[model samples]
Target: MEDCLRIAVAQIPVTTDARANGREIRAAMRAAAGAGARLIQFPEGAASGYPSGAAKAMLAGWAVDWAALREELEEIAALAAELSLWTVVGSSHALTAPNRPHNSLYVISDTGRLVARYDKRLLSFSELADWYAPGAEPLVFEVDGFRFGCALCIEIQFPEIFVEYARLGIDCLLLSSFSRDPMFAIQVQGHAACNAYWIGFAVPAQCGDAASSGLAGPDGRWIAQAPQAATRLLS
Candidate 1:
């Protein structure tokens, strides 16, 4: 078990096109490898693109191609194998008839295997309550002797989740979000300091008003951040 770990925060452009998004993810993974990062984290809905209220309304009648989404995920996992890096990426998970899809984080190991998955437990009443079903369990995974926990988007507003992870003895907390508010950074830093854990926060580059993707130390200081409005990898 290693005491030190290097992770990357990927701030990539997300679009409605899953193919294009997959390509972007692949590019970021290559960049992360060059930077010697063992793991990379992407923003919420990095695979299928996050839908805004208006976009969700428009897509209400459209059919979701789960097969295509799975193919994209497989490609990402393959890239992880090629680069020998772990990845945490956000996407939608399909469920049975009548039930809404889940907003989930897919954890891919360096061996090109789909490892544990973390579904977002907290669904925002204003934004996702109607579209996504809430998940119940917490997700914790170990790498390099460090335990990592997962959360998504607006869930950062709730401190209980972080507290639970702290109690579980996680060394790092991963947050994949689509929020464009400045408060995103503040909340992340606060949580990291309050829990004495590192925080990896990822958000889309093109998200208006969104904070840049980056990693924060347990001291509540930012270790690195991608340039605002640019698709890049920050290690």
Candidate 2:
């Protein structure tokens, strides 16, 4: 197969309202399908834009509502089927079964099946010792003819991980980040410069006080960049 791929990059704003967030994502996925896109990427925590674990706040304990997130993701599954599209989304995973919570990326197939999960590695100081459990293992998921690896948010900073995936002959790299800083350019360029033939998928938390999501080409160029303060679709 050729080493070319068509990806739909979505940069929609997210909120704590699951229903609203779901509705927007469903629409975007449908648009992506209509455009003949095989894969669609969305912002980090696309399901619920709930802020990252805030420190020493009354809401600190409120972030791990596993039951609620499960139901929300189930609906997202159904929506994926409706659109007949594959989706990669960055979101928070509620902790259950005696483990701490995680910032995760969920991969959904066209048939509404949840194919795999990749938890974010390189946890921040906040997450390293508290709030989340560090992710284990590397994920290489296949969609269409594409073999892609998944890494969430800050994990892309670590060059060794992507090198490992490239050594395995991955065709694409899906990176999800929640950064608002200008270093984002460095992140995307670095992801491409090191991997050379690799394309990076970045779906940030969205336009607000923070940065939005976007896509970068193998040449280390921006394919599409969501606005800093507005939600948009980046093809």
Clashes of each: 2, 2
Error of 1 at 153 (Å): 0.6
Model 1's alpha-carbon lDDT is 0.87
How many angstroms is residue 38 displaced in model 2 relative to the true structure, after the best TM-score fit?
A: 1.4
Clashing pairs in 2: 45-90, 153-176
Q: Residue by residue across 28-103, what tens digits does model 2's lDDT show?
A: 8888888887788876778755455441353455443456667777887887888777898877776665677677
TM-score of each: 0.95, 0.87
Off by over 4 Å in 2: 53-58, 204-212
Instruction: Mark the regions of model 1 whose C-alpha exceeds 4 Å error after superposition.
Output: 126-129
Candidate 1, number of clashes:
2
Write the residue-wise lDDT of candidate 1 on 16-132 in tens digits: 677888999999999999999999999998997767544566566434566777889999999899999999999888889788888899999999899898999888884354677
